[model samples]
Target: MKKVLAAVLAGAMLTASMAGCSGTASSSSSSKAASDSKADSTAATSTASAEDEALTCTLNVWGPAEDQAKDKGNWLPTTCEQFKKLHPKWNITFKYSACSEGDAGKTVTQDPSAAGDVYFFANDQINTLISANALSELGGSTVDEIKSSCSKEIIDSVTVKDSVYGVPFTTNTWFMYYNKSKFSDTDVKSLDAMLKKGKVAFPISNSWYLPAFFIANGCTMYGDKGTDESAGIQFGGDKGTEVTKYLATLVANPNFKNDADGSGLAGLRDGSISAYFSGSWDAAAVKEALGSNFGAVSLPTVNIGGSEKQLKSFSGSKAIGVNPNTKNPQVAVALAKYLGGADAQRSHYKLRSIVPCNTEVLKDTDIQKDAMVTAQNETFEKTSIIQPFVASMKDFWTPTENFGKALISKEITKDNAASKVEALTKAYKNPVS
Candidate 1:
């Protein structure tokens, strides 16, 4: 991933710099046009109206270490400068530090006032932020603009109870990373085919990856959006048992390896493993291991009910949220919007190699040319399921992993699969207090 990150960063910087020049030229032409046009008076009136609504405030922001680092492109500062240029009346001063997206909710929940007015957070943290009243709801023109600018999935991921809570900047998900030398293009399309080549590493016992099986076989976790706690676990049903039986067969296969201890990379490096299911986080290491043979694609299809079913993986987004406790809620909301907007998402893709969630940015020819970004985008579009962000989902991980372990140990057979699944479902339904 870092290989692509460096490559994309170089390209993105060039693209951004060129775009900056183009923008300056466009602004100059617009000034000439304004001087010559009769509509100049109307445009001036509109500009004045916008300025009247403009705000003035200092915004303390939080994001990952990369966003804060000067040498790493300092994306936040650049974005703020662009935003300030658009709304010059908004006297936004930013004080930023390293705060992981996953940690934003906890920090705000613990001390709302001290938390940054705007912060980047993971989509899964939405429910927690909402429950704690730590997030401000975006409304009116802001909501309309976001809905128009981003993909539906991106918009839907941050919306709760018909209110948008976060501005999604990039998608976060997993896909298959394989060694092209070991498997041909056709061979990588099916799980069974990949397994036939050599050992394929996946964390089958981990709750995060385990849900893919049940989900592909028509199971629901929590509810449609994972908000209905009463919906319980639907994986224990007939469809789930069928999927479990199929997974048991693979678990029993000698080519299957559990990646619980993080040995998969070592195995790949030493030629003991040919493929693994993971996300962008593992890209740099895996690229070094496979070198020229490294290849990434969507997850392979699994055999279910005598037919091939596309293997589904969970999808998530890293988003920007406004603190409800901010002194200037409107400006904070505007800043959050600007951070997740098309230009910001493009900058993020260039600076951090993060997959942009903005629809227009995703369609960029440059972004489409990057194999890693293209593969991830396609996989999320066709084969990924949105992971629920509901608070009740906190109870799901442990019991699901336990169930996976039991299956791997040959404790869940075709005959007894239903019973074990039922037990696991019961556990998941009963939230951990």
Candidate 2:
């Protein structure tokens, strides 16, 4: 979600003077959603290669918007420059834009002629474009190696009926960070009591609330992939609808009204909200927002199974892929291989505080020592990578957005929700992008 609708909103909201840790609904709301246009390009030196007659040229790279892009912090242009210094034979021209849901892949799909050698895109969309032959297959040997190194859940998500596409670099899941001083054990009796007195943070309207409530109730975002080794989008069907109904129940009750109002971070600073569900990347900022009064916990669990069940945080990562149509597939492969390894992952992890999924590098001493990094590793163990319906999401987002708006706006009633929601889901068609 970080690189889809969520990623676009993050870039717009968190740019420059706006930089801070907070969640938003679209690609423009935060600095985390990386695209291709934010890369800082160096005017090419155009030096002739010692062995070849052709001059070394820059490789065009696409990524997300960044608050601080100098020296390629978080954008491919900067990462490419770092690669260029090591391999002077390769020059990369980077462009970073916080792309909308399917646009990252479609940018190349729509115009194969106009593209950088490499592209950074959300995982699900990569499946679509890769299958359509828009992006290069990462070859047999490399794919096998990446498979062993990345999470199996994530690997399975981007793989279509059979073939695999794209590599993951970001796993986004929720963590419950709280201002410890405000909700000390003796002061608050229970979660219900805390909510009654306005002791919660995070937005009710955000998708994060689902896992929060579900784990609290005991559910997962995915169902078994089946004997064919395929999974179902279990989060949004009848069970998914149950999730919505439960949310409606919570917010409509008026008992939880005060705690559910507005963005959750506002409550954290006021001492009114003691705990919140947030992405791992935002923990440092959440700490700053709450000053010295905070403590971090894994996302809370909601008992949903017959006995007791816990909901885990979502897991997955963002990645760079090569355009299959590129005249320079070799360069594209090199770029992806580099970023997916330890050097770039660690540098980005240090500069931006984002989590890395590369198994080979995640255990590096620098990565393990950072406080935020340490916490991410702790929380990640509790999560399952939630799979969005490759096509169901396309069919789901708009109507779901509208339906959620109406529910939040008091324009719709649960009595009529079945008919309305069904019609809305029926309309959500998966895009081929």
Task: Score each candidate by Cα lDDT.
Answer: 0.74, 0.52
TM-score of 2: 0.69
Question: TM-score for all predictions?
Answer: 0.80, 0.69
Candidate 1 per-residue lDDT, tens place, 134-186, comes to: 77666545566678877788788888777677788887888888889999999
* lDDT per residue (tens digit) for residues 1-433 in model 2: 3224423432242232122211122433112212211110011122123212222344556665552366435444567677667665444355554553236756766764465456777675765665455665453334655687877765765565565556667665656666666566433324444555555654555543444444444333334322211332224445545555655655575434322454566666665566776765566567778777766655443323222334455545566776654443334555676776667777777766667877877778877665555555556665444545454444434554565566677665656645554554445432222
Clash pairs detected, candidate 1? 1-283, 1-284
Error of 2 at 330 (Å): 1.2
* Per-residue lDDT of 322 in model 1: 76
lDDT of 1 at 135: 73
- Consecutive 10-residue window with the lowest summed lDDT within model 1: 36-45
What's the C-alpha lDDT at position 416 in model 1? 87
